[model samples]
Target: MIEIDELLQQEAWRFWDQSLSGKSKSALESFAADDLLCHLVGQGQSPATVRTWVHDQTVVLGIQDHRLPFVDDAQDFLRTQGFTPIVRNSGGLAVVLDAGVLNISIVLSELVQPIDISAGYEVMLEFVRLLLPEAEGKIEAYEIVGSYCPGSYDLSIDGKKFAGISQRRLRKGIAVQIYLCIDGSGSERAELIRQFYDIGVQGEDTKFTYPDIKPEVMASINELLGTSFTIQDIVIRIQQLLQHLTPKVISQSITEDEVALYQFYMQRVLDRNKKMLEK
Candidate 1:
């Protein structure tokens, strides 16, 4: 596993906090933003970046999710539950994203040899561990069976998962993304996905096995740590952690050039999503 310091020892870091951008930003734009950052960072046009985002009532689905026999109906179910559904251009199954869920992405350049897939995951896992020092040994990275988007790098305490990490690579840059269940009921979020799969699969066999989604095996950090930490609190913690790790933490949004690039990426994502859902 790569140490936290090793991954964050850059001379400076760029930080983007878009958690309160309101509903207009949408989760699709967030993924496109990460792709833009990945390209810039990979080409050495930008420093390593840490971005935080939150979208109201959004459910990000994996590519495999679109292949479900009744995916359109499953999406309709999510809409009835007040959730906007979009297929993310990354790995992992469907995951809920609300104001209570804090999403973070660490964009790094693979300038040398390609970064090991596990190494990308370890970077986010170690960063989360650093963010919540109080959790200490309680935080473990392993596949939490029955959890939504369950993966080998699922961040959990005692057995219930609170976060899952996924990676998106572009132009030799890697965007390691994680959604931390900062506040609210993680089980409730899992239950939402549980229903999605139930309606999606309807007892039919799938080439890719979706999680059984035992809601009890999932929890928010607040619930697991017995603390009342909010999204803003965790955002502050991320800033402070970055400050301590690097000499300078630059706060900025994408540049004008990046805005153009972001538009191109956004259109690509929009097109892909429309195609997937329309199928």
Candidate 2:
């Protein structure tokens, strides 16, 4: 687990993307920011940053996800369904991203203490618990079979997964990220991926085992709790939690250095994505 007591006491910055208009912002930009933030923190030029981002009608596929036997058919299906499919330069299965799904990335410097994979996951788990106090003891972090993007650190309530955590490290800095399905139906989201796999795999035996997705195994927080929770409500909760955690939560924008680096990383991501699609 992350040394929470140690982490909260440190100076931190926050970046909340005001992309309520949805399609105005690019999901690839978020990936680039994670790369840039990691470098800045690793170099001691910036403090840890917590960034909130959201993308609409996008399905981010892992490298493994792109390896599906009939991947072209999967891509075509997604496109026809009005979903922009992009291959993420990270490790994870297919995950749905949209305006209702809030993504939080905790970018931390590893200068003082090395953050192992498990510790990184735990930090995000702790943050989720902080955001939803009502879910304190009920939320469990474990793989939920039949859920899209199932993993050991899948965050669930009862038996339905509402979130999943992943990490990326660069230059001694670590970015632990989680996607919270705060609003929309999580089962509906899972069904989309299930269809993608059904079209992509066509019963072919792949070395990597694609999930036998069962949409019933996933649901949004609102659905799980039988309450109407909006993304804005959760954003406000995040701000409150950050204010309580730090002496001052400095709102930041992209610096010149970060902007330049973002352009570089964005190009790399695009190139890799194009290569994957071409394959």
Candidate 3:
């Protein structure tokens, strides 16, 4: 496994905090932004980047989610519950994102050497441990059964998951993204996804097995660690952590050229999502 320090041994690191970019910046844009960053980083046009983002009430669905028997009804249920439903251009089942969830994407270039998928996940897991030294040994990475978007890289404590890691590789760049439930009741969030699956599947078995969500297995970091931390507090921690890792931490937004690329990626994501939801 490539150590986190080894990954951060670069000359400089780019940092972008879009957590408070307002409600206009949807979660859809966040995924698109990562896609753009991945292309630039992979092409050696931009340094490795760490972007933090948060969205309002939203349920980011996976590709498989769009295949639910009654997906339209499930999405409508989400809308009636005051949450915007959008299919993410990545791998993972549905996940709840709101003001309290802090999403961090570490974009790395693999132009010179290929990165194994597990290595990418390991790097992000180690980085998360560094961010919260308080929960050093307690943070365990394993599949938390009965949790929404259950994966082998589920970040959990005492069997309750607080985060899940997903990866997107494009144009020789890898975007390792993790959404941390920083605040609120994790079980409540899990329950929402449980309901979504219930409505979408309608108890009908399918070729692809969906998770039988057990809300008790889900929790926020605050709930797991017994600490009161906000998204802003974690943002500061991320900056400090990166500053220690690299000599220079550049706090900049996307350039004009990047904006043009972002638009292209955004349209792709928008189009893909429109097609999925329309089904």
Candidate 4:
């Protein structure tokens, strides 16, 4: 069995792609052996294979959105805005992204201990904290009431949510992914989610408790830090953490096998999107 140390010691593969490619997800899923852990920095999924490239003009909807009363109208709205609307299988509600947002993923194989959920979350939390240690104790994990995609694991500082984490597992492979609003106005994104819910829900009371979505509750790490936080800065921080940790890290390209796994994952994504559209 490959030890966790050996797994963490390996430098994470950073793929910079402008297009949403199956190869990226394949690398995270099939490329890794059963014991090797996987992480997708910006993919927004655990065991989530693809590092879905959400461009600036993209509007990502959550699964619950299919039931929306004005679904077609919402789709038309998206088209009018030149936003490519797509459905993501993860749990969060609608979230917008562009060049300013930083997405991360951590891939790890499920081990005997059963990778800790909080541990995985904290790993990303700690990863971000390492970037700006001054906010070490300040980075908090709690549902920021009224924030879009509000969850118990929302990462924030001084009451503003800046990042959210989710996990997915495929076979023995696990991928932990997160998106950080590093430079843009975080509240604006929150407001965007608020609008999505407003349109999707159409004021109907449903069993699902959608986030109240207070736009003011979220902000970018840069704004919260009083310094401009750039994706480039975060990229360096991730590399640094791997170097500083006890696990010796080695960065490498995805192998052929992982590519095969991603193909299946991509098919699932495509199928899911198709079913959602049919609804």
Candidate 5:
């Protein structure tokens, strides 16, 4: 695992805003570096970066998702319903994103030692448990059956999954990211994935395996806490915990060099998308 001190001092954190922060061209102009590696909260992140923004009503889809038997139909349904269908350049299937979910990025620089993907995930999960010790037992780290984006590190409570992780490597950087559905109805999010699978697969037996999503096996942190807790609230907690781990947890934005790199990366991401469409 890359030490916290090293991460704090490295150009990775100082370079880019992972994916979410590099929203616009200008934002990218200031927040990306040649070494910026992205770990998406869903499938893959590396080389450039993987970012999972917890925006409201956004449904992230895996590459195979674009190949749904009724691809256009599903896309139209999502579009009409105000859900943007974004094809991800990583592993895994469809997953939900919302304000209630806490999206985390494990940005990496190519200059650093190569850490195993599973190790990167463990580090992020450890940070979560460290940040919120009260929910130690409640925060289970195991694959929940019948969940979209099922993985070994799925964060769940009482057999309910609330988080799914993915990674993205680009150029030479890496971003390992995860989005945890906190403080809301996990079942609702699960139901969304369920519908996506139902509408996309339609009982097809392809080489890939799509999850038979179970909405009941998911719950929000709020419900688990028996109190109302927002993602922003948890963000503060995360910042505080990180501050404790280091003396200078500065809140600095990205630099111009990073932004230029982000533009290049954005183009690459777009190009990648174009290729998929062509196929």
Candidate 6:
């Protein structure tokens, strides 16, 4: 396990917006930025970065989701609900993204030592633990069986899930990502995925067993914590946490080089998603 003490020793950079509104960066752009930064960090050109992002009314689907029997219907249903459907390159099933949801990505380089899957997940878990100190023993990592994007690293309180963690590795760099449901109703979000899978699969018998989603199994952080924590509040908490961990936590901005690299990664993801959706 990589300890927090060891993580603090590395160079850290923070890239986040203090306000939650008007974030125009698409989900694809955010993923590309992570990949670009990963390569930069792997080459020792940039420090480890903690980035926060949010997208409005989008449902990010996994590759398996594109394989659904009635995927076209699912995408149409999502569109009818005023949500844009996007096929993500990373791992995970369908997940909702909106202003109420905040995503955090911890991009690190494994130049010195390799980061195993468990260790990569632990890093994100530890950061979440630090951010929500109030939920000390309540925050547990286990698969919420009925929730959308159910995974072994699902961050939940009691039996209701509020966040899910996923990782993407490239060029000796890793991005441990988590989407925290800060406000709004998590069950409502789950209901969206439930409806999506319900329509997408149409009860067809396939090799993949789509989750029989129970919206009640999901809750937002504010609901679980019994406090009104906004997207900005958590973002500030994360910034403070990173600043406390390192002496020189700087705010990072996109560079021309990163922009060029981002174009490459973005096109790759776009092409992959295009191919998957076309199937």
> Per-residue lDDT tens digits of candidate 1, residues 157-193?
9999999898899998999999999899999999999
Question: Positional deviation of 266 in candidate 1, in angstroms?
Answer: 0.9
lDDT of 1: 0.90
For residues 1-279, could you state the per-residue lDDT of candidate 3 as single tens digits?
456667866788999889899455778898889999999999999999999999989999998999999998998999999999988756789999998899999999999888889889999999999999999899999999999999999999999999999999999999999999999999999999999999999988888999999999999999988999999999999999998988999998888767889999999989988887677
lDDT of 4: 0.62
> lDDT tens digits, residues 46-101, model 5?
22222333456677777888777876767777777766666755567787765576
User: Candidate 1: lDDT of 12?
Assistant: 88
The residue-by-residue lDDT of candidate 6 on 29-145, one tens digit each, is 777877877887776778888888889899999988988999999999999999999898656899999989999888888888777888888888988998899999889999999
Question: What ranges in model 5 sit over 4 Å off?
Answer: 1-53, 110-112, 170-172
User: How close is every model to the real structure, measured as TM-score?
Assistant: 0.96, 0.95, 0.97, 0.78, 0.81, 0.95
TM-score of 5: 0.81
lDDT winner between candidates 2 and 3: 3
Best prediction by lDDT: 3
Cα RMSD, model 5: 5.2
Once fitted onto the true fold, the runs of candidate 6 whose alpha carbons sit more than 4 angstroms away are: 1-4, 16-22
Better of 1 and 5 by TM-score: 1
The models' CA-based lDDT, in order, is 0.90, 0.85, 0.91, 0.62, 0.62, 0.85
Alpha-carbon lDDT of model 5? 0.62
**TM-score result, candidate 3:** 0.97
Model 2 has a clash total of: 0
If both were scored by lDDT, which would come out higher, candidate 2 or candidate 5? 2
Cα-based RMSD of candidate 3 = 1.2
